[model samples]
Target: MLFTQAVRQFLEHLQAVDRSKETVKGYKAELGYFNHYLSVKHNGPVYLEDIQLEDMEAYMQHLKERKKSTATRNRVVYVLRSFYGYAVKRELCKKNHAELLEPVAIIQKERDFITEEELEILISHIHQPVIRTVIQTMFYTGGRITEMKNLKIKDVDLENEVIHIIEGKGKKNRDIPIGKTLHPILTNYFENIRDHENIETDYFFAIPKSGSISANYVNRLLKEAVDELGWNKHITAHVLRHSFGTNLLDKGASLVSIQKLLGHANLTVTSRYLHQDKDKLAEAVNLL
Candidate 1:
């Protein structure tokens, strides 16, 4: 069988299975790029079983030369592995060369967060009620952008001062307690603007009275605040969540506590939020 024919069958399998629409689209695009590379590297009539191991290795190097990130490379490699595995099962290929490919190491980027000083400046300068409240909620609750957008008016417990993330990442529901400093901001946004506007939608940060606030819009708002403060950092809603975790760490909160509050699946993911502080390191050495 031709290599393209095998790839087409694999894609059809993805669409016929449990893969989401977005996942299917992304895999299609990735495989399409791979097919293009194969076409350029060799003349026509490329057979599924004819691809040598050297060709597989060369394609891996080609990805690196294009400066693809570790995650992108890993995803591409995974797709190919699945494809070639299918080909092997169907007797179209002798073996799956993509299976033996080693994954690239993913280096976590430097944690970008808002300093306390920058936080104060950002809050003071944000005059719009909804926009300001959105930032405040993110900073205080450490809710994912999607979680925040999905928040309903009923999710905020004004009496208890808590926000409920009904279905965050992993489809896990969690609660984040409100800090005293952020209480008034959320209270007023809930009781005043959201109520006063009589927003036709029930979402906490719903815009246009039709749908929830989008992640892109939230980031754009954050960018405007960063630009106004002349801060060089490219801060976003996710950065605010990082700031929440880092700030909690500074306040002597445990990694386990942060993991639960941030709805992170494990301690390792939560640990990345704990940035190294010179003063904290000094204090630690002194204790030793």
Candidate 2:
């Protein structure tokens, strides 16, 4: 019934459920911070049953006073709710105190995307053959950086012109079509860089030196490319995905098709990438 016991159980449950390393670490860090706050405030350990609405309110206030962003505060509250839910379900607590707590309001900010012209310029400047191919694939497929990085040779069905996404976010698998424009580049990469290598693994992007490139390495390369191009816009691998979705929507692709291509479970999640122009929205309304 002690806080430490509950924390340990929560972590054990998370591991049992096969949670991602990042997710588990985040939950542990957030809950550990909450436990530390209770200990410091009360001069002793606080049990799950000892938690009150005031304690929750104080935690929210503490986060706010520390100038945590709305998004971060919301995430912390979410973690608390999940932990308390676990406790309640296991009969460790009579009720879920954290469940009733409200998250801070988060304003949905529009994401910045590169224009088609800017993308052309950026791609033109990237000299590395493999890096250029990877960047192009991201733009064309709207695949996450990890999805692309973790891609295997078998995942690409060149004859079918489709790329298989295995174990994407939320453990979902889907296939997206590869554009004809990228086929030649992909074929060349495979024939030149991949064919000669004695790779025992199936990963498509494995380098001769490192085997596989880390997400940090991809981001660093993207940063260097962005700097070399002297573009003021914030660019990352995710931006390439956003650009693909936006481009599709601009070309009048339906939300349903885009959702499937992006492997978004919910249409609402894919709606974020629709990014309709104000002028287009107005024009459609006028026709209506």
Best by lDDT: 2
For candidate 1, what's the RMSD?
4.0
TM-score per candidate, chains pooled:
0.76, 0.86
Candidate 1 on 1-288: residue-level lDDT in tens? 887788788878877765655567787898888778888888665777788778877888898998988888889888888888888887778888988888888887777777667787897877666777888888887888878888988888878988888867656789999889889878777667775455677788866545568888778877887788888898888899999889888888889999999999889888876676778889999996
Q: Please identify model 2 stretches exceeding 4 Å from their true place.
A: 2-4, 18-22, 33-47, 127-129, 194-200
User: Mind sharing the TM-score for model 2?
Assistant: 0.86
Worst 10 residues of 1 by lDDT: 190-199
Which numbered prediction scores highest in TM-score against the true structure?
2
Identify the runs in model 1 with alpha carbons over 4 angstroms from their true place: 1-63, 78-96, 195-198
> Which pairs clash in the backbone of model 2?
none
Alpha carbon lDDT of residue 176, candidate 2? 91
